[model samples]
Target: MNPIAANKAELIAIADAVAREKSIDRMIVIEAMEEAIQRAARARYGAENDIRAKIDPRGGDLRLWRVLEVVEEPEDYFKQISLVDAKERESDVKLGDFIVDPLPPIEFGRIAAQAAKQVIVTKVRDAERERQYDEYKDRQGEIITGLVKRVEFGHIVVDLGRAEGVIRRDQQIPREVLRVGDRVRSLITLVRRENRGPQIFCSRAHPDFMKKLFAQEVPEIYDGVIEIKACARDPGSRAKIGVLSHDSSIDPVGACVGMRGSRVQAVVQELAGEKIDIIPWSPETATFVVNALQPAQVSKVVIDEEDTRIEVVVPDDQLSLAIGRRGQNVRLAGQLTGHQIDIMTEAAESEKRQKEFVERSELFEKELELDETLAQLLVAEGFTSLEEVAYVEADELASIEGLDEDVAAELQSRAVEALERRESGYRDARRALGVEDALSEIPGLTEEMLVRLGSKGIKTLDDLADLSTDELIGKGDKRREIPAGLLASFGISQDDGNAIIMAARQHWFADEVTDEATEA
Candidate 1:
């Protein structure tokens, strides 16, 4: 009934109201009030004093204390007290003990009340931000519906019930107009904790956004009967999804498309009229690439797994359709299949094959002193390289039409001689480039590879060892104009490159072991 008792009751009521309005814990508000009181007490008492404040959550009874350490020597008079002096306050006080001194409650002045209010506001805001972050951090990749709060610099700010999310300009569906107060659904792509607060970034243009939409529309996807293996989107224009069915009876593409195209239509509408292609996913890379380039019939698919590239040969009439307008179709196919796709007409593919045939035949004729007819015959029988002829089973070569065992033996002898001459030439070229013989001793590095490395200024064993596997045999970034690796042209695998580098570094380990043994 007194003024102090009435103030305590009013404090408890305020804390409850703030906690409810902010949707934060009541204890957090009480703690914020305690901090505010502590700040005010510091202003009232000397700033040097170690003052702390506590408020009873149940009764709202405020308490203030000066915390001091008991020490043999009290250098900081406000924070430390001598053991003898501390005993005057507490009989059980010992050196290095932290003890609190109770202080009289002071009435709040106008300036102190304003400062306390600011502190409470700041603390409550910080608690609210932390709660929002914790609540939404795990909600990433989820589809969230919100009202369009505002637009700034082409970015959409959405009012998610408990938090605000931003749809960056690049994350919005192209040419899809959204106005204030309109309901919008987007995928929570990112949640970042920054100095300002937790940033919730939403996206309607991302491929995952379409996949989530499909999950909502298709019951099979939601229940895990069907899985979205891969997705690629061109924003408001078109999108492709590779779906796989766990249950064979339920076709993934059919389930996603739904009866009468209802499910896909729903997703298409949500994505601002984006056309959706629901392709059945395949485990085989070549089959998957062929499926990804839908609507355009593909005659053949040649996949280079090492480079993650696919070459599709289509009918000349379907060339424009296969490549799409402005190359969008092939680009989306590449994205969905995770491979770089090259589309060529059937005629072009045939022409390329003929050109390669002639080139191989000419190589055999020039290198092995073979007549044109025999060299052409060798190329036709799939003998593309000198090494293949030299190392292949003699019976296999003799089994070729019109080639007896004696002819097969003679051809292999010529191939071996030609390979040896090439190796000798490359060795001389490598030495001329100042490449160390130690480099050739590395397991995977041949004389030709050493010449390439030396031309690139990688002549020493240490220089070769210092290079990464990707640097040794990577298909370099074309966009960045980076040259491919020294052994890239030789079709060296990543494992081979790694083995070569390790072999080059073997001597380093040997020297280390020898030095340690010498020291011992």
Candidate 2:
């Protein structure tokens, strides 16, 4: 009971009980006890005294001693002894050798016993936490069931049997309520071991949660016949999952849906009746995108592989279905397919095509001295701009069926003249607008873009740098909303837009330092 009175067997018994209760190794507990007793011995002797305790592994007998190194001259009196003094204690003792002086046992006082207990308890708890962390760290992304322990600041703390998991407010299923003692299933999103303990972060709204649920409901998925490729969820509203079958005979969708939707129904119920679309994954993005937008008949799919964009032309009746309510369906389809999708009705697409045709025809007519009939031919040949006719090889232009080499050459020369004149006029206008030529040097911005920015009172690099990428791209709203992105008409990419903005922002650092120096 009392420390120092407790013998070897009693110390070993205490270690065994502590290790069993904490789920740590008995040897770890024994080491902790030895360290605690060593600290107590140091306290009883002197603070500067180098004392140590070693517990016998077989019998757990405690041995206390003062450890001092043999040195030529005693620098510190507590931990070092002169070689002469050490040689007197042991005839064969050499310099730098540690001399262990056995100390007589002393009773551990109230304070000393409490210090030892704290040390043992702290060590055992650390060992337990370490074990828990190791046990659940590898279980990340796996679905685990737990009871809701409590809710604090919208965070749900779930009580796993051994280690607790936390589901932050954003990770919970939307509109799904939880109460203490309510059992819930969640996918482990992340796991971290900190000084406090292992923090197992879980999520019910994660797309992986739905994937795991389907894995549980469908046998083929677990057996590796069906593989869930990608998943997108709107929490309690809707979800889309792309599945592929390694075994051709097994229809991945049919296997996941089960008989009369039995398997999918089970998963849907678990997700609070969220609607799910099981899409057959395809390597061809167009086919996969068409599959992703299910229940909506696609009349035609035009895929822009370079942009990873899919244009789905649905019938007039299917447009609403293809786009979904508030664009959620199409958005989720894009996410699942990993492509940007543009949904248009057949009628709307035809109208857009006609509009583009007229625009291209007019461009050729004015720029290449082509009449309606001649411009119509160029438009039919898919020559969208005069610049293309001017820049492309003569053979490419001549290859357009009826246009001979002489005619093609003449048209190209006219196009070059027209574009040069147009560019000269744009340069004059830019100067008139007081827009910097430096801004026009940016990769994505054109003369027209400079004029637009200048008209908006952005004339300098400083002014341009003050604006966001969205504003430069025309996506950001000013007094009026520009629904389309910046330089959208000029076909600027988001990456190019970001690069242009960054170019504009290069002067920002210089300007900042100048202003700071001025203020100082």
Candidate 3:
């Protein structure tokens, strides 16, 4: 059969048009068409033949060849040829080189032409998808607008001019109705390539979408005079953004808010009226946190940095506002600032203070056997722990509200007796638990720390070596976070936890190296 060739000018014109339309290289389209033509040619020849098609770029001349690689011996008939046979065709053919045998032109059959068309379409579509993915992957976090093409399953397929993106159901604002042909704006959250094609996933409810909206509306933000430090969203309801300004003249929050809420209102309209709080971010976490709970007026903020938590005290009238409806406000604030926020009213703080005072008063009453009035007096005078009482001078105790000099002497005696009794119990327990003296050699590991360690079954150096840093200086039973109180209790820094654990693990590591060397 004669090889079926299309018109040279027509083939070149089709490739150039397809390349322009698909936003892919013209050469890629030509290569794909060549592959399709090759497949059709292989169908007319035998499937067992190794076929390839080439189109001349200068003249658009199509040629077909059966490709055979030169080898020691001809491996099957289709793909490999003996070196001696290859040498007959070319005087100095190499063993690994391919020899091209020109085949007769293929005639266009109905089935063969359809097969060629299918291959071309498939490759062109694949190249189009790859181009779209590469183009949009860098556009991740950018805001783009598109017409709603259709909804499949729960995803909204958006026809973004040359390409399509999917806005998944969860990513859409909750209960915000959408319809086909509706114009929608979204942030490109993810672009992933899979076997079928590249998928561009979009999100309308993402916090970044709000950020991009602000950037578009506010000149200071877009021009880098102001920055959005952190953003959190309770999509379709409320959101918080922490902003900072490099220029002293620019108030970041005011810049985002615009004069008379013009700038922010534009963004709010796009977000389907999502309530947004624009806060000025601060380098001091307490100041940032205080600002994050906006409109509610935070009266005080206590931060525990190791636990990455902030306790926010607001006025009783502002309590509901600070927490928002269903605690959404504080929760989003926590997410934005990377801190666990606990919101409380001023009355609640006062109640907690009273409850703590009562507890400490009970501790003094139970531990020191002092009178009820005297225990209350000691607690009111700012003495909490028994150690404070035991360590203070007799004259210092006398200066308390109720105690006379003789009463102070008696109190000091009882305080020392109480501590000695507590320690004597710890000493007996330490000996019974078989805690080694070597553990005391660790710096900052007090006798009390050793006793606590012994109680937790970490009495020996090997036992300590097996413990993680979280177990040593962390009070976190869940989430494995280090709490400030635990760090302060040991008077150790965050890095010191790892250092102490490693100090115990030194022998273990040394033994491992020794065994490895011996094996070598």
Candidate 4:
């Protein structure tokens, strides 16, 4: 140790002060100062050049280690020393032996101080980045509350306590708005560690958010009394949640609805007025489907278990309600229940049946000496509708063991003729009943215009039946030209118009008009 070397106690104090000021660790500062001192010492003392120094901050003691090398001559100032100097530094020093010498100094030049400061800063920054990486990498998929710092390009940049998260525009719920400085709580969707920084991803539109919200709001769900089986949503529009209960005593729907709809309302408000329909889930496919189609009573639900399809039947009045406005209600129901739905009305079914009858009318008229069993089979196959049998495929009929293609074709042709005859009869009946087509042809009859005509006691085909074309033309009503032109266009004989009118009067007058006449 040399007196001019430096004060070790004073050097440790200076390094400690520098570490505290720069927010760098004291050990970092000590290491950096020691390296700087060793560089200066090698420049001064060319003897054993390998020299290093480190300071103990608490004890204020200096450690000295020498680097002794075996060589004929030194190559670098800091690395090698002459063999004579190496042996002088270490008595046992031999060829290729290494030594360490610690050098401590209190005084530092401007450049040295700057170099020391840079080293300490670099070490601390690297260590801090490693710490942050370790801390946040394990926090993925957790929930966190953060403040909205700014909105850029429709993305919400949230300032979480230790990191920032980006919520993209598409992830945001539709029709919802956010403001700066608002406290938003979201689930941490991802945590990515990169060399630059840790990227935290959070989401407000995750399905788990809805599930957790329900669990928080409904005690039945949280306490295991009621369980949420499945959920489907068109966010900010409507959501269908299927719920079941483990305990029969618990009503899942009632629990979700709360008294007067408070429980569901809380969730609705949080979702920005989105509608929530909590349906009771059932294991039976038919019963579950019936329940999913809420507010519309299902008369029947026929399930094809093999195909996983459901056909729903509703009454005539309920059909429109079941299908909903633009089919949105049933569509959501299908999504919730995972089934394909087809809706039908009783009136439509009956009309289909009547049309079938008209088509098949000639088949019954045919003197078919067919076996009773064949007739029964045809009837069972929906052939009662003459149209259905008229259009029956020959190959299909031949596929039946007892039927040949020629018989099928004959049956089809006869059934088709019968259907045509039935339609003609129906048309005649319409004319005889003073149907609007007949009246409209009689002229100047817009439904509204004819309604006015009816108001003036010029009602029905028969009332107009008694009057001639010339009589109508000369009557000089304001609508004369139209009436004359329309009457001529109808191209009907007086007898035909009169007969139709008489039939209509008899049919319509008996029940409705006769009673009204009596009352009058």
Top TM-score hit: 1
Writing each residue's lDDT as its tens digit, candidate 3 over 58-96 gives 678887899998999776868899998888989989989
lDDT of 3 at 326: 90
In model 2, the Cα lDDT at residue 170 comes to 94
RMSD of each: 3.4, 5.0, 5.7, 25.3
Query: TM-score for model 3?
Result: 0.76
Q: Please, what are the lDDT tens digits per residue for candidate 2 over residues 236-333?
A: 99999999999978898899999999999999999998999988888887788888899898889998665567789999999889889999999999
Q: Which residue runs of candidate 3 sit more than 4 Å off their true CA positions?
A: 1-5, 47-50, 67-100, 108-111, 358-520
Candidate 1 lDDT, 1-520, residue by residue in tens: 1222236778888889999999999998888888878878888897899999888888878888999999999999999999998899889888989998899998867787788888888888999999999999999999999999999999999999989999999999999999999999999999999878899999999888888888889988999999999998899998889999999888888888888999899998998899988899999988888899998999999987656778899999999998998999999999999888999998899999999999999999998888999999999999889999999999999999989999999999999999999999999999999998988777777898888888899989789879887788774422112355666777776667778889888989999999999999
Could you tell me how far off, in angstroms, the CA of residue 244 lies in candidate 4 after the best superposition? 2.1
Strongest candidate by lDDT: 1
lDDT of 2 at 415: 89
Give the Cα error of residue 152 in candidate 1, in Å.
2.7
Question: Sorted on lDDT, highest at the top, how do the candidates line up?
Answer: 1, 2, 3, 4
In candidate 3, list every pair of residues with a backbone clash: 2-105, 3-105, 3-106, 4-106
Clashes of 3: 4
List ranges where model 2 is wrong by over 4 Å. Answer: 1-5, 430-520
User: 132 in model 2: Cα distance from truth in Å?
Assistant: 2.1
